[model samples]
Target: MDATTLALLIGAGLVGGACNAVAGGGTFFTFPALLAAGVPPVAANATSAISIWPGHATSLFGYREELRRHAGRLKSAAPAFVLGSLIGAWLLSVTGNGLFRQLIPWLLLAATVLFAIGPRLRSWIAPTGSGTLPKPVIFLIDLLVAIYGGYFGAGLGILLMAVLTLIGLSDVNEANAVKNALATIVSSLAVAVFIVTGIIAWGPGAAVLAGAVAGGYLGARFARWINPRILRAIIIAVGLGLSWIYF
Candidate 1:
């Protein structure tokens, strides 16, 4: 990549990591930066996944207690995470560029809309308890969302939050923790798929990874000091701005 593209990737990675650390829309920045850096659609998506996987991994630290307490549930959710991710990555690999491009605007729009509705959706989906939804239903929902994560993943955290919220799941922090943990699993599985299939653009992905790590670390360190509502507004603006670029 040229200096310009490298800068773009790094800048996007920085902001993307901070965005996710603050709220939940890093892909809104990273994916578009990959595309702007001239990576193909499917490859950009794969590389974007690879770039952010580490941040997801690091996010698990905050919820260690919850993860430990809910070990059994986490174990129960693993199969769906792996299976759904593999299937979604496979679907992405087979997608034609033309079709994928056509879908970009719509996908961005969907993610934006989801982000807009995040607060309300969270309230609506707030879990009542385990008895609220059957295991099978929860599994099915997880599998479907994992599939989507494997494919695109821009608004995945929001989707997971909504689903986990609906099952009358655990506390807010626990739900967020579970979401990051599952994201780590599913994104890792999908990364494996992209690696085996050779769809990833290692160069840009590596650049973004470096920046993402730095950004994630800084964001985590300063999370309490930062205004998430401000970061969220920036993401909303970027999401809207990027939608037009793909068109």
Candidate 2:
């Protein structure tokens, strides 16, 4: 890759990792950069998933206590989550770059909207008084969320958080814990699929991976001084700008 493309990919990954570490929505940066660097749309999606996913790991570790408490749910939800991810990843692979390219603008827009409305969606969907949802519903929700997570994963956290809250996990931390785990599963499985299919762009992916790691570390270390609201605004603006350009 040319120096400019390398710079773009690394810069996007850095900003994206920081955005995710501070607020969320790292895909808002990396996906657009991948496309600009001439990665095919479907390939870019897979690369983005792997590149941005490391940032979510810290959040998962931070919520291990909550994860332990919800261990039972993970057992029941695993089958559906894994299956959905497989199907979604296969779907994207089959979609090829052409159809996925057409869908990129819309998908990004949807992700932005979902991210923007996450809190409101949680309040609207989740009853104030409720316990963990029934297994059947949990599996169904997990299935759906996993599919989307494997598909693109842009705002999967918000979607997972909303579903977790709606299913009656009252503690925000608890819900986030579950969301992060399932999201990890989804992305992990998707990465496996992408790797097997040889669609992941190694050069860009490596650039993004290195940048994201550094950015995540920096963002977390300095999180106390960072204004998440500003990061959130930056993500929103970038997402909207990419959508406008792509459309």
Candidate 3:
């Protein structure tokens, strides 16, 4: 790759990782960067997944205490994440580029809408006097979200946050911690598939990975200080914008 393409990938990764740490939607940055750098569409999508996977680990470090408190919850959620991710990744491996391309905008729009409605949806699901949703219901939700994350994870964090909230996780940072943990599982499983399928572009993936680690750590540390309302607005706007462009 040329120096310019390398620089672009690194820059995109940095921004993408920080975005994921803050409010999700990182793929809006990384996926397009790869496509612009001349990678094939399927390869770019696979490489994007692998590139951003490590950021969740660094982001998790910033939420260690929260993670500890929620260890059992994460453990219970793991199997669904694993199974769903494998299914999604397998689907991606078999998808033709033309079909995948046609699906992109719709997927982004749906994820964006889900993120926008998440809090309200959670409130509706567990209105006053009602307890948190049942464990089985939560598990089903996580499985569905994990499948999407494995396929195209731009707003996976927000979707996971919604699931965590439905389980009665009130603290934003704590919810983010759980979100990152589950995301790690989803992406790791998907990446393993991508690796086996030989769809990832290692040269670009490495460049993005390097920047993502640093950005992820820093973004996580700063996340708590930011106003959640404003962050969500920015993320929503970005998601809408990206969806529009893709359409």
Candidate 4:
């Protein structure tokens, strides 16, 4: 890759990592940057998936305290997530790219709407959870979300957060922690598939990975320092901006 392309990839990685750490729309930045840098759409998507793995790992580590607190739930949910991700990744590989490309813009729009009204939706669903949701139900939701994550991870965290909220996780921090860990798991598995298929662009992947790690670390730390309302506003703005771009 040329120096200019490398630089753009790195820059996009920084934005992606930070956004992912904070609000989960990093692909909205990195994917476009990759396309602009002349990577084919399918290759760019594959490469971006490989690059963002480190960011997810960093974000999950940053939320280790919250993860520890919910270890039991995570353990219970792991099988579902793993199974779902594998299925999702396999489906993506088997399905032709044409369908995914046609579907993505609409998916982004739907995800954006989900993010925009998620809180209100949570409130509406709040009363249904006076008691815990059955483990089977939770597992099914996890599996479904993991499938979506493996297929086209844009705005996945928001979808996970919504599911978690409906299932009785009222604390945003805890929800975010779970979202990060699950996303990390799904992305890691998906990357493995992409790499095995020889779809990843290693040079750009390495550059983006470096930037994502740094940005994720900083963003997670900054998240702890910021006010929740401000953070929410920023996340919503970023989500809207991404939606516009994708649309």
Q: Write the per-residue lDDT of candidate 4 for residues 11-107, one digit (tens) a residue.
A: 9899898888887888887888888877777778878888887888888767889999998878888898898888877777766767878877676
TM-score of each: 0.81, 0.77, 0.93, 0.91
Model 3 agreement with the true structure over 1-247: per-residue lDDT tens digits:
9999999999999988988887787888899999998899888999999998888878988999988999999899988999999988988888899998898888777777877777777788778836478888878988898888887777677677666766777667777788888988999999999999988899989999888888788878988887867766765787787789789
Model 1, position 2, has a per-residue lDDT of 88
Cα RMSD for candidates in order: 3.5, 3.7, 1.6, 2.0
lDDT-sorted candidate list, best first: 3, 4, 1, 2
Compare candidates 1 and 4 on lDDT and give the better one: 4
Write candidate 1's Cα lDDT for 161-206 as tens digits: 5566566553445555677788888889999999999999999999
Candidate number of the best TM-score: 3
The segments of candidate 4 whose C-alpha lies over 4 angstroms from its true place after superposition are 119-131
Candidate 2's residue-wise lDDT over 1-247, tens digit each? 9998888888998887766555455777898899898888888889998897786665455556778999987777789989999988988888866676687678667666655565566566544634445678778878887888788766565556556646666454455457667777888899899899888988899988878877765655554454546544654665666567667
Give the Cα lDDT of each candidate.
Answer: 0.75, 0.72, 0.84, 0.78
Model 3 vs. true fold: TM: 0.93
Model 2 misplacement above 4 A: 21-23, 102-128, 170-173, 217-247
Looking at model 2, report the run of 10 residues with the lowest lDDT sum: 219-228
